[model samples]
Target: MHSKIELIDMSKKNPGEPGIEIIESPEALAGQINKAEVFFLKNRKVVLGIGGAILVAIVGFAGYRFYIDGQEGTAQNALASVVYDFEADSLQKALNGAGGNEGLLSIADNYKGTDASNLASFYAGVALLKQGKYDDAISRLQSFSSSDLLIHARAQSLIGDAYLEKNQPAEAISYYQKAADYEKNEYFTPVYLMKLALAQEKANQPADAVASYKRVVDEFPLSSEVVNAKKYMGLLEGQVGK
Candidate 1:
């Protein structure tokens, strides 16, 4: 009986804050110099302290990047088969290992802080979820992050699903809301809102459920989820009306 169990971009071209803030020209350089003269005259110590901190940060970041690149290369090698195993639905092999190859869990731990390790954490969580290891799934999923909005939201949403399966509707509702809030887009926003509404309903929060469903209906009118969102909103609103 499948009732309402429905579940869940940064553009590379635009470099965002880093690109915009970077000093790129002589005219911009003159503006910065004038501002710096004013600022440095008033707060020389503060300025020096900030400059020192930034230098240290730059050095530390460079070192960390060098370290992680090597680690990620090795981890990627170890992870080549594990990712395929996971995608191929060979769940146990994805977690445990196969044919003398390391698994997602091992790559995550052995290559901590690398990009590959972060992906391993996500894959490991997903594998654990499929195997019904709900607690472990939540733990692993919570540790993973990505610059990609969809992946991050999906990881949080997967944690919600794990908690729901564990009969923890309150926790599920929390993560579902987090997922919905993590990325507000036409694609994933309504989908997560529907999940959030279901979790709210499960937790007996009719008002919240109604509000979430109404958000999907109003904000994402053309979404595939909006029809179900309207249906659920009406059901909850009727309950409140009664």
Candidate 2:
């Protein structure tokens, strides 16, 4: 985006022109110090032009930062209103908006770079999931990024569920594995593991399916997943036996 300009002047004459020779560094010419001054002026002009470009770049960057900050503030306020509606169990109002307040979907669509906007995407995804709009939920949830391990894990698991409900066993298994391994928290791990086991079985990898279910029984014995894991494992083993 940034560039510098330079000029090179090399002058020479044909040797046939009365003992003429090549001239190197015209600035070093015997009696043309004045010409050298002109060359220096040209270099100065180029440097000044580069300096002006740099100044404009700095001003542009400052203005962009200001614009982004303003957008972030607006998005935060919009998201707050949506959250209030959501907490009141007014799901439609939270997602589609009401009166003067913008909803989570609107904020996510228009102010994607803001923190509140990112959270809006998550909220939108969860709302869609609750409404059984699985594909739409997956799109929004996958767009959200967060450092919160629990939320991230939940999103991954939800994606797995969506895929599973759609009968896409391979996709379901991938997302389930991501959810199961993401934060390694004891609470959600078994749930995701069971989902993965079911998905693997659907994918027809009976051995891998059994292994996944066995993990829940062995490593998460107290979890609710353990009961279903045992059942699923038994089913897979029986199929293999046949």
Which residue segments of model 2 deviate by more than 4 Å?
Answer: 1-61
Worst 10 residues of 1 by lDDT: 2-11
TM-score of each model, in listed order: 0.73, 0.73
Give each model's whole-structure lDDT: 0.87, 0.84
lDDT score at residue 6, model 2, on the 0-100 scale: 16
Clash count of each predicted structure = 0, 0
Q: 125, model 2: CA deviation in Å? A: 0.8
Model 1, which residues run further than 4 Å from truth? 1-65
Model 2, 1-242: lDDT tens per residue? Answer: 32111133324444456423224433335436666677768798787889989999999999988888999998998898789888877878989899989988899999967888889999988888878899999999999988899998888988888888888999999999998888786788988888898899889899998998889998888887788789879988998883
Residue 35: error of model 2 in Å? Answer: 19
